[model samples]
Target: MHHGAYPRSISNLPLLRSTVAPKRPIAHSPKSPPSTCRHYRQIPEEEYRRRLAEARPLLSNRRAKTLETIGTTKQHRTFILLCVAAAVVFYFANSQKVPVTGRRRFNFLSEDWLTIFGVSGDAYEQELRREGVRFAPKYDWRYARVMGVMQRLVPVSGQADKDWKVHVILDDGAANAFVTPDGHVFVFSGIINLCGNIDSLATVLGHEIAHNVATHSAERLSAAIIANLTSGSLFLLLGLLPGLTLAGLWTLTGGRYVQSLIYDLPMNRKQETEADYIGLMMMAEACYDPRHSIGFWERMKVVQSQSRGYEVPEMLSTHPSDGSRIEKLTQWLPEAMEKWQASDCHGGQGAIARQFRDALSHRRFMGVAWYIAVPGDWRLSIP
Candidate 1:
């Protein structure tokens, strides 16, 4: 054929002409198998379908596993970042000093937070009422007596004009008392029954008031919130760790109860001691003999032993045991007495003592054995 006629015929033949065009060469390693040879090798349709069915499961499983691994890795990275952020927040938030004790502590609660959520004064009182906590009448003599003790103590706690209201809770046989963050005192009649005299009563009221003055309730709330956030975040972080199960995560984080028992309870006990010391000074400053605390706690020990069957060790208890409490009060007695003697309301205000004695007339054990107060003197001795 002529050269021009050959060219036209070649270009017109589609398959042969397209196959001859220059294209970029695919790179292949020298060690790679010769797969180019397999492109020419044809298998029967049934065999190809059989091979595809067998490989399909394996490929699907591998892709699923790869996706799961990537998702888990991303989840772990997110949790780690969250924990780091929480740690940074806690560090920057920092600590505060207690007003009453002048002791520094790890407290991150801001005044606004305390005002908004921490100080549930009226709310807590209403909650208690809803929970069947029978409150003594505001005009009741027992209530008045408790209020009297508070009146004498609050001013000395450096809380002048503090609208500190005392509400006497007459719970059945429960010797417990608590003060709210915004200065609402809930005194139990059982605690009054437990106390020997006005001074012992002063000890109870003063301690509860001191808890308010020091903002212990708010501090505890703040600590618990921070701990819960930290521990929960940390637990999520641990869950992301490779090969960790739910049980393993709990073991690693120690759970919320364990954290509260280890971190929060110990801190609570410390706050109790601080309140004790501050309360002792308050009672003394109010002209109530500090030594009466010994008799009061001794009676409490007897009551607790009879009721609770056994005392929880101080280290494990939220409040120091009766023995520890009495011992600590004893340690501060000297200082307390000095403050009492210097108090303008010194000598226990004989008229107030008379009213206290009259209020105690119903009790059969109202005698020197309960509280040994020297006539016309603030100094007290326990028999």
Candidate 2:
């Protein structure tokens, strides 16, 4: 109580000893922590129990719901992935390689179906013939010449079932020619007039035939079917709204249209380029000058320029532009020349055929009578 000594007042009355100041409570340093844990320790047991009782059910329910949501999401993702895998397998299985170019393509549509659509049915060609003005006396020498060219090309094309035939639609104004999927060739007389030489005509013929040989039409049809089905299924799977509103409907349709334009059009343009390459080879093998392909496309460029509104940009159009076609042909000319020189038929025949075609194109005959009236030597002649 005083100086390091116990008070003697323990024996005496305790109040009688000198009064001692209560020891001051120790001051806390700034760096030292306060006894915060004491506040929690001071809480009553009954209150702690009550709080735990209130929180347990909520925590358990949240945990259960989170686990359930994760399970459901995994299930949905698994199903969507399985659907995509199946579609991929089906596509790979159905694809086939195109001849000459060896490009893999879809062809679920059968040749029988194509024949029914183009060959057996009187709808496509017959309807076209009926609607448009055609050159009469269909057996004219010009047609014969076209048919002759077809005969040469078909043998060289190496198509196993060669049922190729040419129908000369002598529409003097329509400068186009095309081959159907079923081997029906339509040659507009306008093209005949436009072709500067027989080789140029053969170039056009070979190109059209190459389109059929490559089976581009069937590929396009198959792609359209797959694209429609796939896009529809994807939107359905997504649960995207396809409602009465214009915006909803557009959302449903717009994706598919953009998808087709992005995927389909480029593929179509590639098919055109493939056909050009094969056609150049075919013409060369048939003893037609592949170099004249340049000339033909040069002529087409002139025609395309004159018919400005009729043309579309190469990126948008199915066919490559004339300049592109000519450039490609020029690039392949050396290879084509090798094939031409190796051919059994001499290229000189092209020159003579050009002369004969030039002369015959000038003559205007209304019927087969005039066709016969043409010199017999000229009809049978070959250089």
Candidate 3:
């Protein structure tokens, strides 16, 4: 991944992941009293540009050797060949294999490799989630309902249930949500503030899920390797085929490189749109109120506009602006809403809230009051 500035022209963007996941930098600050430090002189824009030009040569010269290592722009053509020759030799050299959706993933990543790339990460993350605050009661119900929807959808996606687990993280201040390649989900509490109801949340989840479903994580990692080994003239690496390295694959999903990829790398916009469409369809199938997606987005637009002079919106942090998203979502609303209503059969937007309210009425009375309210005699008896 290129350690560089965010590109104004995305083609030059780095294939790195985001450092801003679930966290954002404060956008507005009081103009610091003119910097009193000796090195704080403000240069004119023209002078700044001139200084940048002046520095470019020296910077380029310093970076000459490292640039040579990046190889060539079309990483796949040559690097893949080089890596493939190495991979084939490495493949038969060992009987290792990797698994996914219960099928063999990489012929080279066998039982030993799986054990090497084992549950350490998952166990640590589990501890982190447990140490985190528990979400409010209603949040649990929403999570269960959403997970149920994904449970139904993943099979439709042809993903194996035993192999892929669904997860939720309940951070109230977090406006973002993401799913790891292994199906661990992190949903921030701040997200609830941005979205109106289940459908909207579903839209967000669906987008992240789409990234995993499309194997975008894996592909992006390959792209990174290609981009990194940019100038290799090894034609044998071409058509070397998709081989997953246990270590490299995990790094792509879990490490800083992915942070660079999500935020800094030039994303395939078509994939983004495709995820929206597929996620929309999945939400509708789950009997959610798809129209809430519109309301939820409108709220985001409002929040973003208000934040303009104060803070940057989360949508812009990883996604396109609200105006374009709203328009695109609206374009597909008719078809999605039609399917949603049929699956719903009860009504629209209000129906989800009503269902949630009813669940609360039942659970509080049953799970709470029954367990806690009338236990005096029983408690005394037990004692």
Candidate 4:
């Protein structure tokens, strides 16, 4: 109970003081309850500005991408405009008038260029010779007949001054005649048999001659060049599209087929019709009967019908159908007769010869009529 007990009691007094500490009550306001939901604090001005600054580059990149897309679209438009401009210039620059028919056409190849290209009959003849194609000798009747018809036709062909050469191919199976650009005429022996008369032979020779005078070969070559260029450009432009592949574009466009159907075959048929008109006029000018031309086409119809058993649609062929040719020839016959009557053939003995020739032509025409009427008579040869 003295001073030592006092020190021990002081240490115990700390432990007693810790265990008996008084607790204070938490204060609550009547206006608000303790919130169970989260409280959202507004972002500070500096923090908001810092986030905006960080996003600014992303917004600018999006604008740049939009501008780039607009620029690319403008470039594509400008390129298309340029191509159109070029095509317009090219069309006007190469425009020309076809001979005889006097129809407007597009031919960029000059005569010098055509000659240099060797698209002439002479070149074709040489090729034929190399291929061992037998040709009738000058002394042969078939060769003489072709030469005789050509001699009369050339003077009226408007290209009389050109070096004219005639060769009769010995192949009787090929019933065709063609003239080269450089004044070379090739006649198949089979065509002569089909003609059956001198006036009918004249029709064929005149047509071949008209082709040369019209410069059809040069026109064809020039057109081919243009068509190829157009198709190639189309292919390239179509290839630039996003979803289209090259193989898909090729299958879709079918450039060659399109060119053939839309351009080549149609153009060839047009040239053929033009040649027929020009040849009719030439034969009339040469004092040949134009009615015989109709007879010849009728015969051709019978032959074609018999051989193929089915007629090709006119659109699918390079030549006009026999019926079309006959119809046109009939339409043109009156004009040709007027020309023929104006010629020297109507004077003195020439008139008598024409009457006799016309009588023969009428007989031949009747034969063709009989053959056409008897559809069952397949045994009737054209000759």
Query: Who wins the lDDT comparison?
Result: 4
| Best of the candidates, TM-score | 4
Model 1 over residues 146-184: C-alpha lDDT tens digits?
877776775566444345677777654766676655556
Q: Order of all candidates by TM-score, from best down to worst?
A: 4, 2, 1, 3
- Tens-digit lDDT track of model 4 for 182-301: 666777777789999889998888787666666667677777666655544554453343213553666678855665777677877777788888888878888889889999988878
List the candidates' TM-scores in order: 0.64, 0.64, 0.47, 0.66
Clash counts for the predictions, in order? 0, 0, 28, 0
CA lDDT of every candidate: 0.60, 0.60, 0.46, 0.63
The model with the greater TM-score, 1 or 3, is 1
* Native-to-model Cα distance after best TM-score fit, residue 297 in candidate 3, in Å: 1.5
lDDT of 4 at 324: 86
**By lDDT: ranked, best first:** 4, 2, 1, 3
| Span of 10 residues, lowest total lDDT, candidate 2 | 3-12
How close is each model in CA RMSD to the real structure?
29.8, 34.8, 17.9, 37.5
lDDT of 3 by residue, 44-151 (tens): 999999888877465475576545434334664455556655644443443212212121221221122222333332563555545554433434765665565555
Against the true structure, candidate 3 reaches a TM-score of 0.47
Runs in model 1 deviating more than 4 A are: 1-89, 97-103, 110-112, 236-254, 346-383
Instruction: Please state the error at residue 57 of candidate 4 in Å.
Output: 36
| Model 2 alpha-carbon miss at residue 373, Å | 46
